[model samples]
Target: MIACGLLLLCFSRKQYVGKVLVALGFILLVISSYEGISGRILRSLESQYSPINLSQVMAPGGSATIQDSVKWIVVLTSGIAGDATLPYQLQVSHHSRVRLIEGIRLHRMLPGSKIILTGGTGFDGSPEATTMSRVAEELGVSRADMVLEVESRDTKDHPLY
Candidate 1:
């Protein structure tokens, strides 16, 4: 839509605004199409060579055993920010994300280990603890099994708070 509008304007002697709009539209189009292209290529390649299950690649023998003697896991959780209702939309940082999912994967190897999920809805939206609970369920832990602290907001009270 914007591309066509820009084309019309470009042909009508409005070179500056037309070129700017064309560039903006082109950037948006390229960004949108890039996801489709990469997704399609990845789907094709996955169909060709990748295994149907991810566990086959990550773990070989399904030897669910932790390397060291770890009994408890602590996960600092946060909410994801959408495009609207935020400046940059702060979310749980990538380091914290990895500490969660991958940490869950590792914790699964430890028998009788408990997962402690901390953090609440710092923003005025959904609570982070609720989302983290869902993630724990997805990672094979039950809601009854997770220790969730829903009121936590600041990191200063991470261990005790």
Candidate 2:
């Protein structure tokens, strides 16, 4: 949209139409990029799935009150900034950070649960799983309890790994 707007603005005979297209394109971009709006849009799509009853599956003192078979919490990461100069938390995207935190929370609730972090070397050549593992360590998760799958480049490749 932005590209089309720029092209119209540069070569189109009608300058006013080009200006309107450019303005509309910027507006659409802002609407889509805003967190509150985008988050609500995502939530609407996710509303079909019912939330889990954590109370039924989890118990106090890092033990399950019920016979909960679920153990591994696989964290399928989107992408990381992968900047070596930055801290581990800073290198992860917001979605990855949230997923990691939730995975750690669930791990704490389940005594023997493990977190499987997945992602390959992203744009900056740093492994996303390694970055998440470091952050998880700082957050008090044991390295022994974490599994890193750093060969999957994207979500589609995760099942294969």
Candidate 3:
């Protein structure tokens, strides 16, 4: 950025007044990234929560086999768009319907376990609970077993999930 600004100093020289433009560009990038703010919030919230195993989270890295004897099967809501299906969508997203399917199958542990969907924000800036609700219903998750908490976009913060 400093180099680019110096180049722009074709008008004069990049350090028109003590590298002011370069400093300004860096500040803009930092502000636009929202880097520290969101990261700090997430880190604090994560640390506050009692740590659970990867199996506890629906994240892709774990292979823990959830047994049918388990009475409660809570799953994090997959935040990907429900209406999408294409190569690009799959390529770009770590969230998949397959994870939901697995969660549902694992959740069919007798009549006690329930499903919890935990995300509620959309790319279009709309609320997302309705989409999760629709998918649960479509997948034949018992309406009674399905619990929706549309208020939070963070699954880790959602207790049910």
Candidate 4:
């Protein structure tokens, strides 16, 4: 939408404004197409978290080493494609899929841990948590081990409920 608005302004009768809009639109197009911009942004956010060793966590002696204080494994939902025709896994966004995989892995490693899938229905009216739970079930995480927090529409609501 921004791109279209800028492009329209670029073709306007005001020559000076059009020229400036053209330049701004070109810059916006370049930034939008450049994957590195988004990569760096995501990297900056991910860098805040300490890395986890799944191998050590899944080892025979590893279960005894985990902190007892850590109980629930929370997997925050991203957007879903909302395509019923697609497979459950394919319906989830890339980021959400990765998060679900990691959550499932953690749930398997931690014997008594339960996974909390958090997300509400998006604009499509299909609950994100439902999609996530379907995929998790397909991946072998039992329903008994999962908790669906389907009321959270966004990040702000996730922590609250």
Question: Each model's RMSD to truth, in Å?
Answer: 10.4, 3.4, 9.4, 3.7
Model 1: residue 122 alpha-carbon error in angstroms: 2.6
Error of 3 at 3 (Å): 14
Candidate numbers sorted by lDDT from highest down: 2, 4, 1, 3
TM per candidate comes to: 0.47, 0.73, 0.45, 0.76
Model 3: how far residue 9 lies from native, Å: 13
Candidate 3 per-residue C-alpha lDDT over 15-107 given as tens digits, one digit per residue, 9 for 90 to 100: 564367677888877875796876887788889887435365343543334433455655555565434443323322345365566667766
TM-score of 4: 0.76
lDDT of each residue in 1-161, candidate 4, tens digit only = 44555666666666666667668777877896778988888889999997876655554767636546457999999899967888888889999999999898778777888999999997679899999999999999999999999999899999988
Sort by TM-score, best first: what order?
Answer: 4, 2, 1, 3
- Per-residue lDDT of 51-107 in model 1, one digit per residue for the tens? 224353234666534424455677887455542343321344555566678657756
Residue 117 deviation, candidate 1, in Å? 0.5
Error of 4 at 85 (Å): 2.5
The residue-level lDDT of candidate 2 at 72 comes to: 88
How far is 124's C-alpha from truth in model 1 (Å)?
3.2
User: Which prediction has the highest TM-score against the true structure?
Assistant: 4
Deviating ranges (above 4 Å) for candidate 2: 1-37, 59-62
